[model samples]
Target: MTSASLLPSGLRAWAQRQVGPITAVRDVSRLRPGSRVWELSLDGGRPGVFLKAASGVVAYQRESFAYRHAVPALGPQAAPQLVESSARHLALLLTAIPGRPLAALDVPRAARYEAYRQAGVLLGWLHAAGDLRGEHRVEAGEALQCAARGVEKRLTAAGDRVRAAERRLVLRLAGDLLRLGPLPLGFLHGDAWERNLIWSGRTGWVDFSRARFGACVQDFVPMYCTAWAEDPGLRAAVLRGYGRELSSEEEYALMCLSALDAVGCLAWGVPNGDHALVERGRAVLARLEAQAV
Candidate 1:
C-alpha cells in the first residue's frame, strides 16, 4: 500500500527514509487498543522489523528514551532491539522478536504458569542490572499516594461497604508503607501485566513507555493479585525464579500495592465500560481486604 495511505504523513516518511528504497508497510496491528504497531517488509523479501508509533508526542519521547536507555540493561534478548527512533516524529523501528504474547487468557494453564516463572526470572535479572540513570524516579511514598488518589477518586460511585472497606484499606496500607521505611529502588516495568510480555525462545518485555524507577516489589504486585492468587504453584515458582521469598516487610508492602492496583483497575474499567474488568477488580479488592486482616 502507499505510505501516505498506510501511516500518518510524518511517520510514513520517517519509516520509508529509515528502511530505504522499496520499503512497504505490509500489515498494521494494535498491540493494545490505541497502541500502534506495524509490520514492515524491506528490500523485497528480506525479513523485516516491527514499528511502534505513538499518537501523542510525550508518549513518543518516553518510549523512545526507554527503549534506548532501559532495554539494554535487561540483557541482549530481553526485549526487541531499538533500531531507529525519533521523538519528534513519534515513531520507532525495532527488531521483531518472534513470539506470541503471554496473555493469561490465551495460553494453556501449564504454559501460562511456566511463563510466569520465566517472567519472574527476567524481572530478577532486570532488577539486578544496577540502577538505570535518567529515568523518572517515583519514590515509595509518592507511589502509594498516587495509588491512593486513584482509589479515592472512584469511591463516590461505590456502595457504602466498598467505600468504607477501601478507605480503611487505603489508610492502613499507607501506614504500612510508611513503617516499612525507604525501600530498595530500581527500574520498574511500570506495566508488568501478562499482556505486556511476549514468550518466544525466552520472555521478552515490551511497551517501555511506562517504565520508571521505583520499589522492586511494585513490579510484581499485579501478578501477585491475579496469577499468583489463582495458582499457588505459580506463586511459588515465580518466587523460586526470583531467588528469594519476600521478607515480612516486603510482603506487607506488596499487599498494599496489590490493593491499590486493584482499585486502579476498577477505575479504569468503569470508564471504559468493561463490565468483566470492573467485576474482576472488585473481586480482587475484596480478596486483598481479607488478606490484610
Candidate 2:
C-alpha cells in the first residue's frame, strides 16, 4: 500500500531504510486484514520483526511510550523491546513476542488465571516506576482527549443516535469523573482487554492505544472485569504485584472508573463493539452507587 494509504507516504520507505536495509512491504491494510503491522524479514535471517505504524490511535501511542520507557527498566519485567519506533505517528516496531491471544485460547481457567498473575507483575512494575507522572500525566491526558475528540467526531458521523448522544454524555462524565478526589495517577495500559494479551508459549501484551498516566484503576478494570467475572483474588494479586496493598476504597474506585470507561465506549458504539461491556459497567455502577450511600 502507498504511504497515504496508511501512514505518511515516505514513512514505510524511510523506516525500511533505517538501521538495516529494506526487505519487504509485508502488508498494507491495518484494519481490513493486514494493515496493522508488517513483517520485516531482514536480510541475514537473524529474526523477523514487526513494524507498527505511527498513524495508530492514542492507546497505540501509549503502548509505544510505555514500552519504550519500560524496556530499559523492566522490559523483562513486563515489557517488549523497541527495535524501532516513531512516536510521531504513534507507530512502533518491536520484537513481536509469539503468542496467540489469550482470549482465543480454550485454556483451563487455572491457566488463564495464571497468565493474569504474570501480567500483574508487569503492571506492578510499571506502577512502581513512577517515571510517568505529573507532566507525563498531562501529555497522556492530551493524547486521550485527542482520541476522545475523534471518537466524538466519528460517532457523530456514524449517525448512530444513541451512540452519538452517549459519546457526548460520556465525554462530559469522564471530565467530571476526572475531577473526583485526586484521581489515582499512575501508568495504565488504558485498554487491557483479553485480545490484547498474546498467549504464545508465553503471555505478552500486544496493544497500547490506551496507555496513559491516569488512574491505575483504568488498567485494572479492563484487566479484570472486561473479560471475566470479578476475580477479587486476582485483583489482590495485581495490587501485590505493585508492591502495595490496595485499600477497600481504592478497589471500589477502580470499579467506578471501569464503569465510566464502558459507558464512554458505548457512547461511541465501536469500542468493545458489543453490549456486554456496557452491561457489565452498569451492573458495577449500580453496586458502587449503592455502596456509596
Candidate 3:
C-alpha cells in the first residue's frame, strides 16, 4: 500500500549470498499497519523470501535471538524459519503461512467456535513452550523489563502529552500500571495483537520482535485485550487449551504489562495526535481491578 524504501544495505548483501542474487524484490507494502514485510525473489526464482526490517540495532539483535530459540523447537510448521539475519535485517525463508488475519475473521453471531478452538490449540503450544526454564530462555526477562522501562520513559519524556485531552485512555491505562500482580518468567510473544495471528485452517503467529522471556500473562494480553474482549466466552476455549482458567495472578501480571504496552504506544503515537490512549489504558486497568480474586 505504502512503500518507503525500507531495504537494509548490509542485510541485502547477506541475502544475495545466502539465497542467491535478488533478481526481483516485490514491495508488499500493501500489508497495513505495523512493519513492512517484503517478498524477495532471489536469482529471480520461485518461493521468494519474506523479509522484515528491524527498527534499529537493539530490536534487530533481540529478534535475532528469538529466531535462534524458536525455530528448532517449534519446527517448520510453527514460526517463520530464519534464513539469514544481521544487524539491520532478519530474513525468514519459511513456507508461507496460509490464511487471513484472525482479527478479520467474521462471525456475525458473535461466536466463532472454530476460530476460538484453533486459537486455543496454538496458544497452548506457545504458553507451554514459552516457559523460561529451558536453555531457550534468552533475554526473556530483559524483554519484559524493556517493555516496562520503555513505557515509563515515554510517559516521563512525553509528560506534556500524557495530559492532553485526547490521550485520556493512554493516561488511564498508565495509572493502572501500579496494581499489576505477580508472575513467573517464560518465553512470550511480547506483542500478541490479533493481526499477528494468521488463520487459515489453523492459526500461525509471526513477528518475533517482542518475543522474549517474561510473565506468562504477557503472552495472553493481546489475545484478551484486542481479540477476546468483546466475547469473553471465548476465554473458556483458550483456557481449555491451557487446561486452566486465566489465573488471577496471570491476569494481574498481564494487566500491568498491557498497561505498559498501551501507554508506551500512546507515547510513541504522539506524533499522530491520537486521543484514544487513555481509554485503552483504562480498559486494561479495569480488567485487572475487577477480576481481583
Candidate 4:
C-alpha cells in the first residue's frame, strides 16, 4: 500500500481531477524495479484506475497513443481504457482490466493454450486496428532496410558481450531479411510476450510502451523465444487463433527476427545482471543454430 502523500503532488492532483478523489493507492509494479505503477481506489466506489508513471516522454507518448488508437480495436474487454493523461507529469490513468499476468498464472496446459489462443486473437485485432494509409504506412522495402539497420546497430553496441558465433548468426539473419523482399507492415505491440498478457477468464493485453508500426511478424518474436520455442503446439494454437498460418516469407521473417531478439536479450541482460534474460537469449540462439544446421 502507498500513501497519497508519497505520490508527486502534481500527479496526484491531476489524477484526482480526472477520476475524483482517490481513496487509496497500492503499488503494483512488478518485473521492473522502480517503475511507478499503482492501483487506485476511488471514493464513491467508482471503478478502480491504474496509474503508470512513464520513465520518459517517449515511452509515455507511445503508450498513451496506443491506448488511444490501437487497443480499442480489441474491444473494451481485451485491454485497459485510457481514463485520462497528464502530459506534464508523464502519467496515464487507465481503467483497470481484470486478470493476473499469464506468466504468473499456474494452469493446466489446455488452459494455457486457450489463453495464448485468445492472446493471438487480440493481437490480430490490434494489428488490424487502423487503416495504414498516409503516414501510418511504411513502405515495405524501407521498413526492411530500417530493420536491418537496427539489427546492425544493436549488434555493434553489444560488441564483445555478443559471442563470436552469436555475432555471426545475427549478421547472417539480418542478411537473410534483406533478401526476403517486402513484408506486411502494421501496428505492433513491440513487446508482446506472456508476461505482458493477462489471463483470468480470457487474455487481456497490457503495456504498450514499445508499440509502433512495423513488420507484423516482429510481434511474435517474444513468444517465439519462449512458448513457441518450447512447444510447437502452442505455436500452432496461437497462429490458428490469429486466423491463419504465416506465409513462407513470413515464416522466414520470424526466424530472422528471432535471431535479432536473441542477441538483444543477451546484450541487455548481461550488463544488467538479469540471468533469466541472458539464458533465454542463449536458448533462442541454440535453437537458431540447430535450425541452421
lDDT of each: 0.70, 0.58, 0.60, 0.83
For model 3, the run of ten residues with the poorest summed lDDT: 165-174
Query: Can you write out model 2's per-residue Cα lDDT over 151-238, one digit (the tens) per residue?
Result: 4454444344334444444455445444445445577666677777766545567666556676565567675555434666665555
Candidate 1 residue lDDT tens string, 23-136: 666555543356677787788676688778776876776577667766776665668778899877678898776577787446666776677777888778766553444434
Higher-scoring candidate on lDDT, 1 or 2: 1
Local distance difference test, candidate 2? 0.58
Instruction: Judge candidate 4 at residue 291 and give its lDDT.
Output: 79
lDDT of 4: 0.83
In candidate 4, what are the lDDT values of residues 1-293, reduced to their tens digit? 34632677777788999889989977777656447888889999788999999979999988998888888888767899899887889999998888889898889999989998998898898888856777678542366667766987788767787778878888988988888876777788888988899899888999888887777888888998898878988998898889988889998888888888877887788888889998998898888888772
Model 1 Cα displacement at 114 (Å)? 3.0
Error of 3 at 5 (Å): 3.4
**Candidate 4 versus the native: TM-score?**
0.94
Displacement of residue 177 (Cα, Å) in model 1 is 2.2
Task: Kindly give the stretch of ten consecutive residues in candidate 2 with the minimal lDDT sum.
Answer: 27-36
> Candidate 3 lDDT, tens digit per residue, 161-232?
444542444444445543454455566666666666666666567777766666566677776665567667
On a 0 to 100 scale, what is the lDDT of residue 184 in model 2? 51
The segments of candidate 4 whose C-alpha lies over 4 angstroms from its true place after superposition are 1-5, 139-141
The C-alpha stretches of model 2 lying farther than 4 A from their native spots are 1-9, 19-35, 56-64, 76-78, 87-90, 130-134, 137-180, 228-233, 270-293
